[model samples]
Target: MPARKIKLSTSSKVFYVICYTVVALMAIICLIPFILLISGSFTSEQFIRFHGYSLLPGEFSTEAYKIIFKTPQRIIRAYGVSIMITVIGTFLGLLLTSMTAYVISRKDFKYRNWFSFFFYFTTLFNGGMVSTYIFYIQYLNLKDSYLALILPMMFNVFYLLIMRTFVSSIPHALIEAAKIDGAGEWRIFFTIILPLLKSGLATIGLFLALGYWNDWYNAMLYLNTETKYPLQYMLYAIQQQTQALASIASQAGIQVQNLPSSSLKLAMAVVATGPIVIVYPFVQKYFVAGITIGSVKG
Candidate 1:
């Protein structure tokens, strides 16, 4: 009555071992850089200047982190701005993307194909950077606005298409049954479709969150106020200032000891990346499922 265990042939065992070895090696290779990054961030600036980065820290120090945290108020403000932008953008993006995808994926929608094409065409061609800047600044007057950061990344064409594919995979009969129960479009979407699209929502939401969190380009272009800078831009500004200080010191024949330039870069990365790394594990199952399902159909 017990299930029989399958026996592997010698060649099969060898093949299994090879596959496992290759995968393990690839995973370790990917992990090595991150390990070095963390190690280098804690390493003393003098040691790093004398010898390049290594897997382990040589003469451990927190000077890089100390330099970064010197302006604690600014760092906290930047963290707040980044967090607020990421949360709001991700929520709005997922809602808008899911709605658009659901509408387009409906079989009975009269102009679905034409609307899809219209969206797809924009991806192929766009107004150049000069025109876009003019429009955002001159026309929209979104200069120095948080919307500048959120709006550009909120509704990606590719994410919409992926959501559409997920929606299309749902059986039409389920939707029809909901309609038969006299449920309105809004009701059906909220009560039926939204619950069923958990994996898809999590996948797109994470992408939107990452985009908003990492965005510094739109901030540089649109924002003039130092108070409005996000975490990434704040780190970038600090790096620039450090480099400038080093340059001026060199020109004046004065050596700037303990500049922390190389180590500061690694420290900034650790700060920016720590939150996402913590959050990813929670949604990883949904992310993998959504990717698999979305890819199957399209």
Candidate 2:
């Protein structure tokens, strides 16, 4: 067969140009703030006061990073907590979700629909924050613990739904063939079904990992110990304290003199985000590829 020729009309070419232009402009709007934050982190304290936020620092210095790096222990501990939670939570959550999805995707299972419904109902309604907080603290007695951070968010209904949809698309003939070969349900799931669902698994796994990495709400509500704070909550407390002191020092009615408060805040933002900024590309490549392939037929 001869290859078909392709052509674009002038109007279509104009539309493509317009879309590319709009996308580029929007990207710049979003990217400028991040650039300013990074560049501002290196700005001198005196220069920051005069020039405010900018992509190009009026005067460059590393004093803020010096202060932050000097107190290495706090930053290190926060990173440890973040990594621990992110790793453990993402693995367990992915395992449970995939297993549950495998079970629910079975049409022959009489109660599969009911089970799926039971899971779906959770998204439409959830225990309010106050009740959920009290339940975790007073009933579950998980306050000031790592479990407080991990347990509440371990499994998400949304992820389960996505996984179930993906699993449902696997050919039923595959399962019937496995049964004909005398494979058990567990064996079929582990040996055959799971290997086929790698794209969906990768996408959902990344979602769960990012969720655990960025979570500070659970710690804010339940954790009391300074030692247990995740990276985000630690950053929050540091920013709050820094701002408060800067305010009080200004109350003396003198030119507020302090270490690089603005610059330090920006530096902390960079440090706190270091892991995700580094890890996102690898995981998200799998995620984008996964979403594209998964959506094609199912």
Candidate 3:
């Protein structure tokens, strides 16, 4: 027997067209800024100053990128530092978050609610910036340390809650069946829970990775050494120096030639954001699945 094909009504066809048109427009709106950013990055400083930004590069030049990569060694070092921090922080943070969520989500865990409340309460209130700075600097002795970048972003309560929701969705009978087969907590977690939590881990891991990769605030406060700067902070430092130079030159009644200020900002953004953008597509499926599954509560 041939399967029947369902045909859409006239109103349904019109509705579909409208939805597609709206979505396409929204996508283009979102994409326009990025297009302008790339175009501006490649545009020459003199042209940008005279003409402002355009949808496409009117005067193509790599001078901004050339100025950025002039000292290749420093750029490479910053890249290395950012990569190291992101990798280590994401791994540790994911592991700890999953473990904590698993423990809290277990029905038999005594004081689970109390612990959840404790974690939740922290989200609602904090010791403020002054106290946090003092605690990290004075007590933790993390000043000028790489740990300064990793530790602060390691355990987000929001990520913990999301992971907990994922863990809670797993059937208790499955866990009990594993226990009956003589699997200990560690064995069950490693063999069963971890494998099933792939989507959740990818989702939370992406958030953690992005946070660590883009963090310059912790660096500005705790890191005093130039050698310890991450990619983002290094770019930030470069921008600051360029602005300061222009300011000083102006005060001295001189025009700073070929400073590349406007285009340099655009170039810095491209450099800092390029790698993370590449990584997003690979984990996008898992990220979407995790968010959807974790949102539904039983």
Candidate 4:
């Protein structure tokens, strides 16, 4: 079969050109900084000191990476910690959030509105950081604990609302039919409701992963020992050490041997950002579809 072509008016043609132009420009705008970051990471420290950063390296060197990996054990351990927490947190958080949202989404469930309000209210008002910190430290005794890093991020109120809205849009008749089949609530939820929430699950899962991967605040507050530090916090500690070395060298009127200050910063940024950026492509299709469908009704 021949495809029918719909002709566009002159105005529509011009609009298409404008839209494409805007999108192309935006893509370049997002890409240029990353290009500079990669190039800067490879640049020699001395060259960067005199020439500043360039899109291409003034003189290429791997000393920055060498310095970062000089103590390979530390960096590798941090990487492991970060990866472990991110995986565990994302999986558990998604399960809890989806289950909670599913219950609230059901029309026949008594007191769903009250429970929804209870969850939603937390988003608007929360105890201040000081009190929460005290509670976690004193009551929970979570100091110097990995749970400190994971628990804070386990469930986000906003993500819960998104999940609830998406699940609510599923047909009532479908759920009724599931019940008529002698399927219990747990069975209906696990087998039927979950299968249909793929897009929403992908969207929420991505959000949870990013949150866990990039988390440094909780690590900073709760983690006292070096081995417990995640990658971001470890990188931060390295940056601080570099800065301290620079300061000491200046004070002693001596040259700091292999001060990777500039390149180290750029390299750290790349290392920290690289993995998570790779994740977006896998979820990109589900992300757009999920947000659009979930937000359509609510």
Candidate achieving the largest TM-score: 2
Q: What C-alpha lDDT values do all the predictions have?
A: 0.84, 0.83, 0.86, 0.84
Clashing pairs in 4: none
Q: What is the lDDT of residue 34 in candidate 4?
A: 95
Which tens-of-lDDT digit does each residue in 185-283 have in candidate 1?
A: 999999999999887887888878878988999999999898899998877776677664465335444566646778878887788778877887887
> What ranges in model 3 sit over 4 Å off?
1-22, 243-256, 293-298
lDDT of 3 by residue, 1-298 (tens): 2332377788878888999999999999998998998999999988999999998999999977776676456678999999999999999999999999999899899988898889889978999999999999999999999999999999988888889877877898999999999999999998999999887887898878888989999999999998899999987886788664465335444566747778877887788888877887887776776567556642
Q: Candidate 2 — which pairs collide? A: none
lDDT comparing candidate 4 with the true structure: 0.84
Error of 2 at 65 (Å): 1.5
lDDT of 2 by residue, 166-195 (tens): 898899999999999999989999999999
State residue 175's C-alpha deviation in candidate 3, in Å. Answer: 2.7
Ranking by TM-score: 2, 4, 3, 1
TM-score to true structure, per model: 0.83, 0.85, 0.83, 0.84
Worst 10 residues of 2 by lDDT: 247-256
lDDT of 3 at 16: 86
lDDT score at residue 8, model 2, on the 0-100 scale: 71
